[model samples]
Target chain A: MYSFTKPKKKQFFKEDTKLWLVFYAISVFLYVSFALFLLVKAYFYSKNNQIYNQNIITLNTKISSLTLQKENIKLQKTIYEDIMVKNSLIKDSIKNLLDLIPDPITLNKFLLKKDSLIIYGITPTKDVYNLLMLPPLESIFTKTDTTFYQMPNGWYKFKSINKLKGNNETAFN
Target chain B: MKLPSIKIKLPKLKIYGIDVIKNALFFAFYISMTLFIIAFIIAPSVKIFKNAKNSYFLSKQEFDNTKQNYRHILEQLTKLQNQNQQILNAFKRNFNENNFKLFAKDYMNIIKITKQKTIPYKNQFAKTSYIITAQIKSPKNFYDFINNIKNYKNIIRVYFPIDFEKSNKEINLTFKIETYRLLTAKAEEKAH
Candidate 1:
């Protein structure tokens, strides 16, 4: 492009040649300055691209890990919930058994030993004691074993064995 | 007559390949400068803007895929939750039955055996799987109790303890037990 600006200058002292020389100097300076700017910009742009790619890779990794964590948590919840249900069943079983204890069998002292019960108490009369000693009642009490202690004060210290399913009145006998 | 003895002084300049090379280098420097200014500074900025638009489109596509995956996971989680609810309801119904009292009685008998042997039941589990442990103070009593337990119709096991100490009247024995009923029930249900 500069070839179009060539001049017919046989004499360096001529006014026209001097004018062209001045223009050439200015153009050289402008070109050199522009080249330097490009070099600096290109270096920085390449660096920016490298960093951008790295960030995308890091984000992709994090997303995958989070997905795995979510799946593990869901599985854990199911297992934990099943355990809670079994525990509730055990609790309800205890409540139902407590409700079955009969009235009038005033329980004075009760001890739970192994699968049996030992009681120390007074029944109003011996007939009531005899009635309670029957097999249906005794079977309930002796499902494990029941023993009673007779005190001199007419108050008896009684011990009896009870299966959790037995009649509650057997405790009085 | 006036031109006699006149000598014109000329500018003296040296000729070397170095000067030609310098001139060629300067010219090339100028041309490359113009091309690079347009290519690096101006052209790339345009490309950068275009790439920004491309990035936005790519991110949008990725976001859509992630959202779809999230929706699928949510659906699976909801189904699991519903199944869990049904299982819990069934368990509750079973627990509230009249026979629960009998089950407690049986369970208490086992506890009594444990206490008679002076073994404490551990309430905590070791791993994600189920674990059971038993300790007996008297080996003779434990032997007898084990015989009785074997006669009973419940499924159970007694593992030998790794460490046991025997002092005087009691011989301590430790064992482990596990159940497949609660542990693998869900997987079996799914299989069916």
Candidate 2:
């Protein structure tokens, strides 16, 4: 009679264990390197984020200040321009009103200093002289004290001072 | 001579529970590591790319919006200044009270075919413009009033065919008229 038993597989897989260990080491190394890369990236990203936030804050402040400055400059420019325009308008109005004053006055030796105007000339006729000395006409031309000196040959020189007021509202023919 | 031999046999070994558990744990660890690579590393990089693209687009949009508004404000300011200048120039010619009175009287005389009614005068814009409201006796009076306004010097526009009430004496017609005066030459030139 012969005895019988089940047979076992040989240790052929043990020879490939080193290969599996190398594969496991490679996988672990790859995983660790990737993790480090991510860590570095995250650190840089966070640092950049902080810098960006700071920059945004600073830029926002600058923008606000710049906007305020621009508005102030605009307002100042408008105010200065308005003042210039008003001054020019007043000067032109004075010139035009003065022109409306009778041409017969024949402004000669005219000197304007401060608030006074000194005029020296001779009136062509006595009648024209009297008209200039009248109340309403005289009042328009001379809003202040006036002095006149009569010389030879029916000639007279006058010195007058006028206080400027609201531009001439009188109608001129 | 003859020789006889017997065949050899070996016993089977049973697998241990510790060895099975060890294999299962190794498999689980490898699967978890693979999942981590895909989830933590690959996904975040993709998200960063998308965000960068979006931020660039938004920045350009903001710049364009601000630039357009700046131009519009400048245009409005210029237009206002021009209109002001035009008004100043028109006043330089003559818009005195006497001229207004003369022009009004002439207009009334031309439309004498229709009955006229007195209107209260209203002044505006530092007395530069005057408004008057009156009533006409008939529709024909309204027509004549319009024509007269067109010929008037200081009178600019007239509102006629206004709401009215029917009366025994005449048809009550209410209308408004406007008159403008030019600024003095000195004021006009200065404004320019």
Among these predictions, the greatest lDDT belongs to 2
lDDT of 1 at A81: 50
Candidate 1 per-residue C-alpha lDDT over A27-60 given as tens digits, one digit per residue, 9 for 90 to 100: 6576556555554555455556555566556655
Q: Looking at model 2 chain A, which ten-residue stretch has the lowest summed lDDT?
A: A164-173
**Deviating ranges (above 4 Å) for candidate 2:** A1-20, A40-98, A113-121, A124-143, A152-156, A165-173, B1-22, B31-192
Candidate 1 residue B55 C-alpha distance from true site, Å:
6.8
**Tens digit of lDDT per residue, candidate 1, span B1-192?**
577887865444337523444455446765776577666665665566556556655655665666666666666666765755544333222112123224323322222122122121122112221122233443334444433333332222332221223325433323333221222334455787
On residues A34-71, what C-alpha lDDT tens digit does candidate 2 reach at each position? 65665566566555555555555555565565565454
Each candidate's interface RMSD (Å, one decimal) is 13.3, 17.7
Each candidate's root-mean-square deviation in Å? 18.4, 19.1
Angstrom error of the Cα, residue B46, model 1: value is 5.8
Tally clashes: model 1. Answer: 10
Against the native chain B, what TM-score does each candidate's chain B reach? Answer: 0.31, 0.30
Candidate 2: residue B13 lDDT (0-100): 36
Candidate 1 TM-score over all chains jointly: 0.31
Deviating ranges (above 4 Å) for candidate 1: A1-25, A28-32, A39-43, A70-74, A97-173, B1-192
